[model samples]
Target: MNCEQIRELLAGYQDGELDGAQHEMVSGHLEECADCRAELAQLDKVKEVTGKVKYNDLPLEVWEGYWQGIYRRIERGLGWIFASVGAVIMLITGAYYLVKDYFMDPAVALFPKIGVGALIIGGGFLLVSVGRERIFAHNRDRYKEVQR
Candidate 1:
């Protein structure tokens, strides 16, 4: 195997994932290639160090405390959800009357005025979007010319 092939297989070889034939090929290559040998040595050192490192074990009391914290958060989250639902119901009820009193009335009204204002704002936004697109396209063409 070439150096690149050996390097690609080196990680799997170190992890004992290679078959016997593949292992032999890598071993043969490592023997002949100084670079692959050095790489394998480095991988072996990393595996050795990682294998020797110790992990801290959590106690049962710690696990209980973690669950307690999670339960408290869940309770608080549920409370917020209920409060938000209540607020939304209140807003819908309040808005119903306000909209009826202000807009649905056939007398001197604000609905047509608000509708015209919204149309004007929407038109302005459309113009701004088109202008931005044109500006970006022009800048992009200039940048391409500079790159060339």
Candidate 2:
């Protein structure tokens, strides 16, 4: 067999997938061709090491429940998102009306108005600080790129 044919069939020969005629032809070529023999040797060593490698096998039930677990987590996440959005909307609406009324009322005390303004500013600063911290933490998370 020529070098091109031998190279094409090399993997099949190594895996014992070649028929009797093809196997004999490849064997004869390997005996006379030093390059093909060396290549075959490398392929054999790789196959030997890979063959000895073992995989961790989980139970059948674990595999069956895997999708269910993922689905439940996604469901819970969506529910929490909806609930949180609704709560934020209500809080923002309430705060907007309260602040509007406070500012519009000329009879309201100045000290109380200042206190309310300080509280709003403090809450905004806290929210921004927490959001920035969370973004930095997520960027630094080592397993963030890992597949679930």
Candidate 3:
């Protein structure tokens, strides 16, 4: 067999997978061809090197670092949730008192109540707009995951 044909059969020959005739043919070609012998030698070296490789777990510090990052994210998320809840409760209570003590009182002028209502509505819209813009920008930011 030629070098190409023998090269193709070299792996099967190495593994003893070829039938007797093909094995002998490749063996004869390998014996005569220096290039084929070198090719087979390289293949053997690669197989040996890869076969000796073993998997090992990462160090304890590595695992700890990963868990710490996860825990920090969870803590910050919970803190934000609690802070937002507290702010909402405070806003609702303040609005209730303002309406009960001033808006519902007959002594308060009409213009002042209208001004306060407009201020509250305007502030709420601005807050919602800023929040939506932040969320939109966050969603569109391409470099969010890139650390400096």
TM-score, one value per model: 0.36, 0.45, 0.53
The total of clashing pairs for model 3 equals 0
Error of 2 at 146 (Å): 4.2
Lowest-lDDT window of 10 residues in candidate 1? 52-61
Candidate 2 lDDT over residue span 1-148, tens digit each: 6898898999999989999999999999999999999999999998877765522234655666777768876996798689879979987998888878886688999999999889988998998899799768856662563444
Candidate 2 displacement at residue 96 in angstroms? 2.3
* 2 or 3, greater by lDDT: 3
Q: Give the TM-score of candidate 1.
A: 0.36
Candidate 3 C-alpha error for residue 108, in Å: 0.8
Give the RMSD in angstroms, all C-alphas superposed, for model 3: 14.1
Best candidate according to TM-score: 3
**Candidate 2: global Cα-lDDT?**
0.84
| Candidate 2 similarity to native, TM-score | 0.45
In model 1, pairs of residues that clash are none
lDDT of 1 by residue, 1-148 (tens): 5799889999999898999999999988888899998999999998877765522244666688778968976996798689879977986886677567755677846778598558756976997899699769968975885587
